[model samples]
Target: MADEKRRPRPAAQYGPTAALVARNVERLRKTRNLTIYSLSAELGKAGRPITPSAIAKIEKMQRQVNVDDLLALAVVFGVSPAALLLPLEDSPRHTAEITGAGAVPADSAWAWASNKRPLKFPPGEQRTAEMEYALASLPPNAREARQHPAGRAIEAAYEDVTRVIVRAAWSVEGDEHEFIDALDQARASLERTLAELGRLAVEHEELVRLRDGVPREGSD
Candidate 1:
């Protein structure tokens, strides 16, 4: 197993503010051998102009870190935000490889052939739900009814569709392509649904802006 670093203090130890977020950022970087210079350079190339000096300052807790910076760092490290947060005791050790195996690829194939399966997302169902939510948020002029109704009916309809996606995905879970396909299906469907919803919402949000001299609080 890889050497596990000492976990940091939980936010409860510091309260609702920044807490140990910076420390977690630094720790994760060190754990992955991602030097401040390398990470910041990567961030810069990715269109967020960040300097190594700035990265160092942020890690030292001398500079404030915003959500965008934190998010960029997390993505670079390929870790969940929660992992960089929420202090834990006796957290299980993480190891990326199974040792004592023959060729790694052969071992991977063997593992894939084993009982475990991949989980898939239901493209149709997810889109339906997002669309329904979007439709409900539309203004009276946008929908036949004055106010958009809750998309419960669509959600219920998509339940079975989602189930199929999940079941199918479970059949190929460990394989990267299959797993990614499952994720992509969910993401793509929902995003397209959201785009449609956003267009409709924009219309309603716009009308509210026009109706009242002062824009509504929820106005886009």
Candidate 2:
């Protein structure tokens, strides 16, 4: 058996988020007229040396991006890392006049397009219980729509995605087969995480009602 075949797959810990990032990456890269090869060369000049193929994989969500990759991309695009991570709605506003690929003033061409402030979590391993506690303590009424376990899982999953992207972007020696397998497993885990969070939310609400001395919908 070939070593590549024997190795585990790449985990898709941040599958959807990675896919979203990839779209943004592609969109922004195009805005700057960068081909995949050009982007690869730029990264190589910066000591990262991401191959065109790997870049393709990332954009396609078949691979991941790491912290280093994100940083390099930020530099290449002349945008903040936060800009790269911001939701699609916050991507640079496009105008027909600016669509032709020539020089565009950064200020007028692209501003973080979000009306609301985005949540800022500590990047990488620095995220700890303090963050979780803070998230949990947000007034329940204030967060009733999105402060659920599913939302937190999505946030954590985004972090995991950045890690996976870093690994896939920087490590060229790993078994490709195993790396791909890891991605598959990670994606599965994310799906399960979402499902489990939904189940827990229902149970948690019922428990909260009981603890607070509230009756069930049909109580005597």
Best by lDDT: 2
Best by TM-score: 2
- After superposing candidate 1, which stretches have Cα over 4 Å from the reference? 1-17, 88-220
TM accuracy, model 1: 0.34
TM-score of each: 0.34, 0.39
* Angstrom error at residue 102, model 2: 37
- True-structure lDDT of candidate 1: 0.54
Question: Which pairs clash (backbone N, Cα, C closer than 3 Å) in model 1?
Answer: 117-170, 118-169, 118-170, 118-172, 118-173, 119-169, 119-170, 120-169
For model 2, what is the alpha-carbon lDDT of residue 89?
A: 37
**lDDT of candidate model 2 versus the reference:** 0.63
| Cα lDDT tens digits for candidate 1, 1-220 | 4698878855322322244566777878888898888888878876676788987877666676677876777687787664454332211222112222222232222222231111112565754544454455545554333223323333333433453465465556565565456556666556555665677788888788788877567768
Q: lDDT tens string, model 2, 1-220?
A: 4665576876777644455577778888899999999999998998888999998888887777888898899898898775665443311223212222333323223331221112333466334533454456545653443345676566556545544564575458765664576576568668867886888888999999989999888879
For all candidates, the clash counts are 8, 21
